[model samples]
Target: MSYTIKPWQDLTIQDDYMFKLVMRRKPICKRMLEKILHVPIRDIRYSDDEKTMKFQYEGKGIRLDVYVADDKGTVYDIEMQVRKPSDDGLYLRTRYYQSMIDMGLLEEGADYDELNPSYIIFICPFEPFDKGRHIYTFRNVCLEDTSLELRDGATKIFLSSVGTADDVTPDVKRFLEYVNGILSNDAFVQEIDQEIKRVKKLEEERVRYMTYAMKMQEERKEGIKEGREAMQHEMQHDLALKMLKDHKPIHEIVRYTELTENQIRKIAAENSNVSFGEESGRNV
Candidate 1:
């Protein structure tokens, strides 16, 4: 027996679709973020550029998909990824984004006197770290002595997908399960079904536009081909007439002629300046 292996395509998450679902569940995520970071979220602003919000963790460059700021000048770099990442991979990405955010604190001529707190949140569909069932939070600490603590800088929060739903809040669990695309039970499924419907509608609209664009591209290619064929035919016809005027032999003309026999005969009659039987039929 043979099994077919399918190629994996990157999951395409449209900005509008993501925003709609995320905005709907913003309160839940915000609450969770505040709880995990122990920071008060003065305000949450959704980015206007959808492309920026859709950046993947595996991609190059440092970009914070969702950025949050509090009244205390703390910045939160919030990201949503659909796949599980390794420890090295996780820390590398987190540190990259954190460093970029930290660099923004000191301007060209400004002083590094005041630095705000920055938090990086990785909300994944699968668990990336070992933190048991509930949400896991991490912060900088004294690794050598284990007594000293660096509490002013960056932090990381991982939203795990494993374990029973009873471990987390009802709203948070519902939101997580929805993000994971796992509607195991009826009640949870029903709650997420409405949001799923909205996403589907947006997907359908995107498909329609893609279909129209493809059709237009194909039509344009066909038109160009037709025009080229027509020009080629006219050029061949002119070449054949010139050859006939040179009094080329019939056998040689047949070998090299771009014209049909009837076309050659018409040229021959016109060059001879004689009225054939069908002369009055149509002007040659």
Candidate 2:
């Protein structure tokens, strides 16, 4: 909550907010996707680009950085992951996002075959899988027979900017290097840099970023408050347990812990090993 907010002027393409803004640009988003996918994209249209998609009866929703669908109905969710997550966490996140995308695309009574092909892409400034490859793409396939492909139409791609292998094209490598804080004259990178500069100068975007920072700070403060309260409650419960173990009177234990008689009774019931040393009928 006490951390400094990064000035809009200091933001780069790697920043989450900056990345989302740049990806919102149709040309940049399309080209970036093409560069990562190594395929030509005729055109792309936004689909729940900024809006968080919520599923029926689901409380939590997913906010995708860039969600778009190409002319062929193939969908894409592109995210810039600056922090390295646990391997399992990252994999589960992609799985959840994939499921959410599917839920958002298919309507009630729609045929299963109507589902469009989709890709969940995460761009990381650090090596994610430690494979030393610029890109790692995943698709479902039969485990026993490696040659057998599932053709599930769902793909998850992780791009590591720190990759050492010469597995990606020069343009892609240049972009990745820029993400890794190495400046380059690549046309796309230059355009993205210009866009970041433009966004920084816009008063409206600056205000938006400020609002976002404030909200994040408030959330952090609230989380800290809740944690402290929970810790205090747990401490009280622990103290009450110790007192009970010491054969302290129920009323005395309640007075120390500030716990209700019924609550203390429940605790005692749960921990039957604590023997009572005093009468149960003590005055409040």
Q: TM-scores for all candidates?
A: 0.51, 0.80
**Candidate 2 similarity to native, TM-score:** 0.80
Error of 2 at 178 (Å): 1.2
lDDT of 1 at 223: 69
- Highest lDDT: give the candidate number: 2
How big is the RMSD of model 1? 17.8
lDDT string, candidate 1, 177-255, tens digits: 6556665554534544554555556766456445644664676677688889989877866666666555555445555
Error of 1 at 67 (Å): 1.6
Whole-model Cα lDDT per candidate?
0.57, 0.86
Q: Model 1 TM-score?
A: 0.51
Q: Candidate 1 has which clashing residue pairs, if any?
A: none
**RMSD in Å for model 2:** 4.0
Output the worst ten-in-a-row residue range by lDDT, candidate 2: 275-284
Q: List the residue pairs that clash in candidate 2.
A: none
Off by over 4 Å in 1: 1-21, 24-32, 35-42, 46-60, 107-110, 144-147, 164-170, 183-196, 199-284
